[model samples]
Target: MPPEPPDTDPGRLLAELIAIDSVNPDLVPGGGGEAAIAGFCGAWLAARGFEVHRLEKRPGRPSLVAVARGTGGGRSLILNGHLDTVSLADYDGDPLDPCIRDGRMYGRGAFDMKGGIAAMMVAAARATAHGPLRGDVILACVADEEHASSGTEEVLESFTADAAVVTEPSHLEVTLAHKGFAWFDVEIEGRAAHGSRPELGIDAIAKAGHFLVALEELAQRLAQGPAHPLLGTGTVHASVIRGGEEPSTYPAHCRITLERRTVPGESADSVERELTAVLDRLAATVPDFHYRLARGLHREPFAADPEALIVRTLARHAEQTLGHPPAVRAEAFWTDCALLDRAGIPCLLFGVDGAGAHAATEYVDLASLDRVTDILTATIADFCS
Candidate 1:
């Protein structure tokens, strides 16, 4: 495909973006990182009079922080979207070949995010086309939103805005809250001995079974516990488990890796304590239930005030653009909204109507794409005015 002509039409721009392979290497080994895509965005924005600044502290993993500097004294706004996408291997068709049928555009990243990126780029360009606003309109086209949010993390180090809108796919709804997650590894220890000798050998895998049952009970307790208004109850599940070398010998070590999805009022510390309590009880009750617990990566859940300036502004624009008040919704998955919120920038998630994010088939409704672009353009103009 040829380079897209410099224009504000989001659908056209989305087709161009989907043609480039920006699969996250962290998610898929040997995957194309954000260098090519980031460069394309920087050039595209720079051509439209944005002051493009590319941040690539992690070598090839670059993130562009393009700014349309406002006249001054007005609240700045950020339009954020991820450039990196999930792997293309599992996609049903030619993931790089963007196709438009009916009203949906099918391709990898089209719905997962590149749709939002195109919309925000066009919105930013159109919003400031006539003249700059009183405050800056910053476009953060960041990398690694699929595996880790290191891209947004780096962007926050240098730039900030009064408010932000993470254009993660939301079916055009206003997403105010979503779940967070923490990973943990549990190692169940046991003495290795001959399998034929029942008394001499303590089966680590069998002992680990006890912990698995406890984990299920814990999940059930969480499900029956107090739930968040939007996100509902927190939950836990074992993701990966490995133990023993061969069937003939008593497996000395068993490892269980689990993930806990959290709602508001929960944190890594809380999850650690919960797991520790469970393990401690097992140690006390089960005769040889020795184990070690370690917490891994975690991100906090996000919730935005419905009345927040950004949320209200975007909602208003969406309502006007869609002919109905945008529905307020929440997600089970996490996004960069939490990072933006943690950075002290009031933010919320809103984006084009779409489906099949990271699935075998992915698509974004073309009409929804145009509507989101219009809504964002108006919101940017209003919020930065």
Candidate 2:
């Protein structure tokens, strides 16, 4: 392996980054947001000769865009990573302190993605070190990925690139696809009555149970249906359910919040149609199946062209770095890659290997971090030039 750069060494940059509290407040209230961390990243990029731009979509959340300008004959490239992380409420160790044990750096955002951010930052700087490229290399360090991803959405309002790479931790693989999701809340209505008058009271919770049973059947059907080549079958499950006020009185209403994970072809509208069909069948069979399905948030799934120049460039560099072709696969989770793809930027997801995101103990593999940095450095140079 080549000697690591001192100023932007993956481990050191990640440790310094992890030391700053940049938890997304929207996910868990009172936790630090991305303002301070964005500032730190902005300054770091500025020192490396990037033209930095700071943006704040909301009051507290901020995102930084650092551009290494080029001579304007080649395709522009965007290296993107989120700044905000999930809450650190129940973490086992000090979530901020970077602990190096067994060559892994443990911290709150260690695996889930500060490692990717560090790698991309260093890689961008290294790509532009020798001389300016023929096209710009943009590093978009955005905020609120753990929640709504408002940061990336805001940045996309004005920024455009020929191709983009979201450093979203795919075990250092070139992730070409991933699942999207739609959230919905089904409210079941019932009549309240005293416990003594069982005949008069309608049990909303009990009715909800029937819906859950039907949902299980739906899940079974989904499993039996056609699957994506890489993503497998899409699925659904109840996330939060609430009903009943007291043991004595039957609950007047029940609310079940569900998330439907959609593959490439499935969308929120299609998913809603699936749920509506199930509900329609239930309403026909079950007595008084009074319910309302309210739509929540929906994020589109991402699928990149394997033959795209950016994908080919990264894959070639990855094979050279690993001595084998990097595995291309799909992720079960969503990322800002979809947003970029939607904005006409063909993007792929790639990042370092690690474990335990938003879990008890989080760490990023040190070796994998360096490998990702090296590969991305080469990829940035090749794609932009």
| Candidate 1's TM-score | 0.98
Clashes of each: 0, 0
**What would the TM-scores of all predictions be?**
0.98, 0.98
Our model 2 lands, by Cα RMSD against the true structure, at: 1.2
Off by over 4 Å in 2: none
Task: Evaluate model 2: give its lDDT.
Answer: 0.92
lDDT of 2 at 356: 92
Residues 1-385, model 2: lDDT tens digits: 6666579687899999999999898878898999899999999999989999998869988899999999989899999999988888788989998999998999999998899999999999889988899999999999988888999999999788999999988998899999999999999888899999989999999889999999988899999999999999999999999999999998889999999999999899999998998888888899977899999999998899999999999999999999999999899999999999999999899999999988999999999999999999999998988
Cα-based RMSD of the predictions, in order? 2.5, 1.2
Candidate 1's residue-wise lDDT over 1-385, tens digit each?
6533459779889999999999999988899999999999999999989999999999999999999999999989999999999989999999999999999999999998999999999999999999899999999999999988999999999999999999999999999999999999999998898888888888999999999999999999999999999999999999999999887899899999999999999999999999999999999999989999988899999998889989989998999989999999999999999999999999999998889998999999999998898899999999999
Cα deviation of 9, candidate 1, in Å: 0.8
